[model samples]
Target: MNGSPASLDAAAMTNASVEVVRDVVYGHGLVHRARPGGPVPRALKLDLYLPARHAHTAPRPALIMAFGGAFHRGSKENDAFEAEGGNTSVADYCLRFARRGYVACAIDYRLVTEDPEPGTTPVVSAPERIPTSRTDVVRRIMNLPPATPDMLWRGIEAASDDMAEAVRFVRSRAAEWHVDPARIALGGFSAGARTALNVAFGEKVPVAAVVALSGFMDRADLQRHLSGFDGGPAVLLVSAENDLDYIAEATPGLVAQLRAAGLHCELLDVPGAGHFYQADAVAVHDAHGATTVERAMAGFLRRTLGG
Candidate 1:
């Protein structure tokens, strides 16, 4: 036996071990789009947070988290601010989902490039000065870039398109991403929720389920793109009752349509909260019960994607 210990080899140690992927695997998978004279040929960068191997192994269910900023801008990270607050970063969801036995991705999508010209109309945020119209809420959706109807519409479409690409990218790398293609799902908050719904309906892709936080889809929009995909997937709808407009105007009819169309739809409503339950969860959790949103969402995922 040698008296001296064997010399350590730094290269050998580095080569033998897999790179420790803590936090997330970022800017890896890509989705490409070719637009005529488009400013950017490549769009969207994605991040994946993997859970413990034993907890969630190969062919795991995957969910895509989209951020909301009135469709203009957002980070792919969960820590990306949720104006409504309760967000612990979409990455948190990915990590937690991975822990609970799933693979999750936070993907980027293109936003409306055109911001309204400054001073064309003075921006007003004061409670008294604010418009009491539907456009007002839409305007507030984005922190930057004064949005108009057309810009917002394009923003929604662009974001939805890129998200679809993300989904397709996941499916294309199903083996690499360790995802079960059949169980893919989409979820988002507010504007992001709208994007999620748009992806669910606008594209012809097959997803096992959807988790929409404070959002809904128009039946007409769904029908418009019905030819692209076949079959209806279950949906988990979460909302705060304090948002009267959503409760009185949208949710009831949306739920009815979901049931009428034979889609499994579950609605979780917080009786005393406002428009941004997620934000409230982050900033004023006790009053809003923001964490509950994740609990119910996880439960739904466990049931829907557990298989």
Candidate 2:
């Protein structure tokens, strides 16, 4: 979706009263053309948030957060989840980091279905066809897919390129945002997480660290190559017991590979949580109650981005 202020302002205001308790911060959203690609034929844009009271130094640590929608659909806006007190959007998380003294940017990347070829039937049909019991309609939307291995690989590459461009774009305009260029890290969920891992683990781009919530690294060979790079970004992988996706099973192996390659990696498997921890209302209740994901993410940022 468009990251226009009008589009996000209401959500932000609706969530304003929802206090995260740990930190208080302010964030702003800007739409910048990071690259020119896809059928849209326009500059791909992303939203950035800065910590409260942050002053631009020569270099400031930053975090690039990406959301997941199975590589076919997703927006920075998708992180909005309703809780008892108020709502928590991905923007809120970005603001939290900004409050803690880090520049956080949630990005919008091109997805597979952005402009599907005319008359070509999609590999995965409508969400209603999936028999999942989750009531979240968004999850149903994520069920549609480019199911083939080739399509999956292509999506991964496109997203990786988009992410690389975003990193470069942020650093390129660091002066304008009062951000430090050297300490940028990356975070994403599911497919977005996959993109983060692929890019961070790939040779094409270099980041300080990567935080993945239920994401796996593609192209094992490329991951091995990343392992050999000295001081490559540290990685944090978070998953839950109820995760039915390949990520839960795959992360351990990826962690092993990264460690074998001499890269620092940390994994957190939340007990009884599912594919998307926020998928179920009760799970959301439990996750929020424990502050499991947020706590881990905060700790990770403090170490990796110096927030």
lDDT for each residue of candidate 1 in 70-124, tens digit (9 for 90 to 100)? 5555567543554445445565565566566666777766655542221111111
Tell me the deviation in Å of residue 202 in model 1.
1.7
Candidate 1: stretches off by over 4 Å: 1-38, 54-56, 78-86, 114-146, 223-229, 244-248, 279-291
Q: Candidate 2, residues 1-307: lDDT per residue as tens digits?
A: 1234443444344444321111111222222233345333434556666443344244568888777766666577565433222223455567666666677777776665443222221222222332222223443556653254444444455666677778887777677667767688888877777778767766347787888877765434445455447668888877777664556657678878777777777777666656656422231212223446677777766666674
**Residue 50 local lDDT, model 2:** 49
lDDT of 2 at 132: 25
